[model samples]
Target: MRRLVDRLRYLGPAAGFLSLLRLTAAAWAGDAPKGEVMKHRFETSRIFPGTVRDYWVYVPSQYDPARPACLYVNQDGIQYDAPAVFDRLIAEKAMPVTIGVFVMPGRVEAPSPGALDRFNRSYEYDGLGDGYARFLLEELLPVVETLRTADGRPIRLSKDGNDRAIGGSSSGAACAFTAAWERPDSFRRVFSAIGTYVGLRGANAYPTLVRKVEPKPLRIFLQDGSNDLNIFGGDWWMANQEMERALAFAGYEVHHAWGAGGHDHRHADVVFPDAMRWLWKDWPAPVKAGAGSPQLQAILIPGEDWQLVGDGYRFTEGPAVTAAGEVFFNDPGAGKSYRIGPDGEPAVFLEDSSGADGQAFGPDGRLVSALAKTGQVVARDVSGSQPPRILAEGFPPNDLVVRHDGGVYVTSPAADPREPGKVWYIGPSGGKRVVDSGLRFPNGVTLSPDQSLLYVADTRSHWVYSYQVQPDGGLAHKQKYFHLHAPDTADDAGADGLRADREGRVYVATRMGIQVCDQAGRVNAIIPTPNGKVSNLTFGGPAFDVLHATCGDRVYRRRVRARGANAYDAPIKPAPPRL
Candidate 1:
């Protein structure tokens, strides 16, 4: 009877919306078994202050309280008689025995009758942040762990992400995705039906973000219909399609089914059973993401492999590209710097590099470096003239960036222990002054294309700080910071090197991968390294679009849509009308 009502509600929606609703109804009904409904409510003071969420747990007869069972989480409360379906599927051995937890969004009750309670649906379900995921893993799941099955089997849940799955519809669908995306190590399988991947609560930015981030080990199943909502937020069907396209572009293990129905759960019901099977098909074997996207493939040559550029060094830092697309990096520990020419050959660029850890090229055809051992900024012309000329003296410079105006800004990490970092400006007249201070382990620094802003990466924290560049070579409003996150990793969010493209995409070399942030300071995508730790990166090639990364002993390259902020952007004068 409930199934029939669900079908009727789905059919009432627009033609395009019916397919999704119908499929959901069928999927749920086909898998559900005949079972009794059970309900339980509990309150805990351990969660966010004054916030209480009502959660429903479904237990099937096939669940043996004598042993632990797999777990599934459904956002937006429980639906489709999940317990019955689990019982049937487990009894027939069609699916693994699992305990289902359906949870409702939290609400903060009003202090008085005149005031209304603050419902957290949109805040918890639609937002593209990790607060909700944190709430679940740290608070909700821990509380659920205290409970036991009817047979007294201590409900021991698997800590492995592969053993966990999350599913939902509409806004709940978005919540499910945000959870898995933010914490892929917690949930690896996702089932989304008629997902609210639109503008509501910043969900619309997901498509673009998906394409930019490094691929994670996640398998997603998406379903939506043409007749879905076409309201102020966005067209649900269109958003889902865009998500599918972005996932494919990023080489994610994504599958989708489109129908001619509307925004309800009917179509999802029909597909739910199959979606479950697909999501959990290989269980412990694990599902792997493809070899990145086409753009990534074009840049990374699979057969070429990562050859040892050089080794036996204390620390390798700073990579810069020349006009010929050759790369030169510093081996600070060995007090030497090597260059990799376009022909993939390594040669000594400078044996006495003055203990250089960070290097870049200035527009005047000279290489600029941060000489940590000498506490100075130096510039050396490639013509192999005399030794490097001191551009500015008296500061423990860590990383340096050269502006088009011939000015230089170098980060000093040893300036103060409490603050530990400061950006110093070196005027074209050879005068030096402190631009800004109070940064935590500032390691990498770069300038925007127009030189309007400077980006600094803090290797000790998970934040990338940005500062506006004043015309007089000073920094302003330096508090703006962007987050760089990875799946349950250590504080290695430490971004070591920074670079930017014409489109304002900032790439920070980080521990888990290269975290890409857009103009708005949001993490758009992540580019993982074949090896985990990446110390630095730079853009090369004739057009300045090929990205080269220095990870431990290996170097990797990739192509991107945006062009690098080359020091020299002017057209070269024709060579004396040769003759």
Candidate 2:
């Protein structure tokens, strides 16, 4: 018995090592075509100044200069004889004629010989941001465009995301995914191997984010092993499985392969050739996403989806539409407000607008707002006249909702050390009274369709508190705080804004998409945004059925079955401006 147990332990390690050798042999045997491996050393004059990198390109033999070829990007340098596989696949008519670019991480040489080389692998590969993607789209690809194929055919890459793919392994795998996740317009299909979707550098958030974010048009293939790393960061195998499960739950077009091996390129080596086939399974035909989860279908229209209205903003928030169906939003970080006119173009509305957080139209035809800088509830007439009149002051206001009776309730989040966050009601006469207290990070205040209850979203606690509205404009019977559900791995839902439709469904903009709660305080459905970390949302368009979401720097909208509440039901046209 003792001998058998000893033999089992040795067998495990011995088999693992042997498997690694086999994978390495396979990789070397599948070397790319000699002329296909074209290397270009260039300096990026625009971004990451004083940085240089080696960009490797592989143009398939069938590529024609007259017709643009599909593009594929692999981070962390080249891998697994990609050129050879691409040549074979294109010849076999399995994938479109594609141009593959393998890029090495940036490096800064040490000032002196004694110091070590300033390797930027971890910095560029591990951080959670769009810097790496920008390096590829803005710097690397353009340089590749100047090169020609061995046949002297000029290289022209397709700009459509449907014709492009990006992939990598380990930390590079996370970087590849971050690129597509940050800028889906550049690359859509993804191939990840032994992916570092773990806690090394906030990569573990992907699983939770997948479910919370509105599903992108990306098609992903994940490869991992049962015997992968189990260390301080996290279990790579478990994280990979979690990501797959979340993707499945969110209705993304995702496929994955699980194996019994450790953390390395060995499993990926054996799988890369097959992964390429699957990543490009469909050629010019686009990949379609599956219907969202049942929880999501309730709020989101089955056929309606997010459409990009505009881009290039410092920080977009507080999306609201005017009576003419034109949208308006704030770029608080830039200290400017913009309006999307009927022509679909953005123009400045207000500059230096007191750092507005939330904006809504009141029944009286005035723009009601929660100004963070002034900590006041103010109302600005449409005429854009003298300084706005303050409804109430002396509290750090975050969001506000106007009741049918003309009173306003604002959320005061805990910012200063001396004050705890509270919900206050401001009477029509500008009198203030505290309604509720002792909640966590109150934000996104709204009312029920019947005007009998108020909903307050506690951003940090994953719960939306419901309060009964009394006749005198006070809250009571504060029971049934609906808990916002999310995967255990994610950070607290960043529930920042709230809106409601005529059907009495309350839409709470959360980190994991918008949680839709019915009148009974039950989560009837979820409406995901195209991107994660949506800051706020509002219903717009002619019928008020279009949902506009403020996701970081981008703004997206989708049509829905429910119609938004008419905040300004009695439209009283603003008095004509005096000359």
Candidate 3:
């Protein structure tokens, strides 16, 4: 009877909306054992200040406080009659003994009667980044943990991501996916119904991102209908199809159901129970990340995660790798530089680094560093046998690179935000000049594999400019070549240190992680650091096949498949890029 009613919901908006209540009431009529629904309000949120919202906690009868139970989080309060569904599923052992958290979108009250209240549904649920996830993990979940159910029973949830799941409909569905996408370490399962995976809040990029970024350990169940929304935002049905295809192309564990109904929860209500069965099949067994697209697989090695090389630094950056596999990085705030050699242990290399912000190995077997505070670029032998030689002075260089011909290029960010930053080139004949100046704040500079092109990251924008390297090492034909993705929290990409691989791929360390762009300049993959902060990275290891990144207070390294194409080495033209 419930399924028949839901199937007929597409008669019209007024009729469909009316039919939904019947489904809800029917959910409450089942003879299945039930759980307690505790309603609560959250008025304090630092992430989305002044916003207040209500949330409900569904504590299953089978949940035991002694053992932490699995968790399921849903947005836009409760839908699909989830509590009754959970009651039946738990009793039948079709799913784990899980606790469900149903939350409404936030609303900020107007200061006075004349102003309208600020609604946070679209702002919170449709935007990309870790904001919503942080709100849940750092704010809401903690507050819920403090609550006590009847009979003094406590609400204890499992901390393992494998034990957690998130789901919702429409924009809320997009929110659920974003939360899991940004923090796969905290939630590994997603259920998206009539998802707003369209241009709303940049979510349309997910189809492309799902194929480019390193795959996360996630399993998803998507539900949508052919007759769903097709308005200014986008076609929900087509977007869902793209998502399903993208997931399959990337080898993700994905399941879906198609129907002829319109944009509503009707179709989902009918398939909700079966979706849960498929989602939680093989309970306690972990969901796994995938062998990504060939592009990503060509760079990342399976079973190899980022390993901490060193920590306890004030701020680390400017990773430089020597030919013999030694890696060196600087702590600018601490005014120190360190080296990791054959023993794989970091040791102090230079106690007085003169505020080195970026460094690279020179063609002459020397280390060239850009001293940000001292306004100098200096070269020192890796063996520490000679005094440092000043390559250039009187310019605040944030990062620099040493070319194979003994030439040097430095990025000098303008002290004033109103003025554009400048790129400095120091010739092999010992002359320095400003090559070009236009980027908002040029921070990281590198050369192409063939050494015929230069790439510079604008720290204040989403562009990584590319220029043709002229005969005299001057730059020409500048264009915003590499387009990067910025975090929702920031105005720009915050693009920093840059590197190129032997395969002609450019890696730009940004706030969103390592945005890897192919020769044609489109981002092909995003590799995030373990700490979600990567200032700079360089290919190192004995074969130049390991990636080392300086991630603010910690340095991490991961073995990969590509060899570093150093500006200091002989130029070898890479194969043409895939268009």
Model 1 lDDT per residue over 1-579, tens place = 566555544432332355455445545655545433335554453434677778877766666655666778998788655665566566666567777888888888889999998987887899866677888788777767777655565556676777778889999999999989878888888999999999877888788767766566788999888899999999899999999998988888888877777887777766666577778786767867555655455344444433345555566779887766667888787788888777765678888887998888877868899987898789987778767799987778888778776788888886556766777888977889988877778889988666777888887788888898887888888854778774433544778899877666678888767887766777766777665558898887788777778887666666655567664443222112111
Q: Number of the top candidate by TM-score?
A: 3
* Worst-scoring 10-residue span by lDDT in model 3: 10-19
Query: Which stretches in model 1 have alpha-carbon errors above 4 Å?
Result: 1-47, 64-68, 300-391, 394-398, 401-496, 499-507, 510-525, 528-579
The clash tally of candidate 1 reads: 36
Model 2 per-residue lDDT tens digits across residues 140-161: 8887898887678788999998
How far off is residue 251 in model 2, in Å?
Answer: 2.5
lDDT of 3 by residue, 268-365 (tens): 87667767878899979999998989888889999999999999999999999987778999999999999987877889988888899888988888
Weakest lDDT window of 10 consecutive positions for candidate 2 = 570-579
Error of 1 at 337 (Å): 16
Off by over 4 Å in 2: 1-35, 42-52, 149-152, 307-399, 411-423, 428-430, 434-443, 448-496, 501-536, 540-544, 548-557, 563-579
Question: Measured by TM-score, how close is model 2 to the native structure?
Answer: 0.72
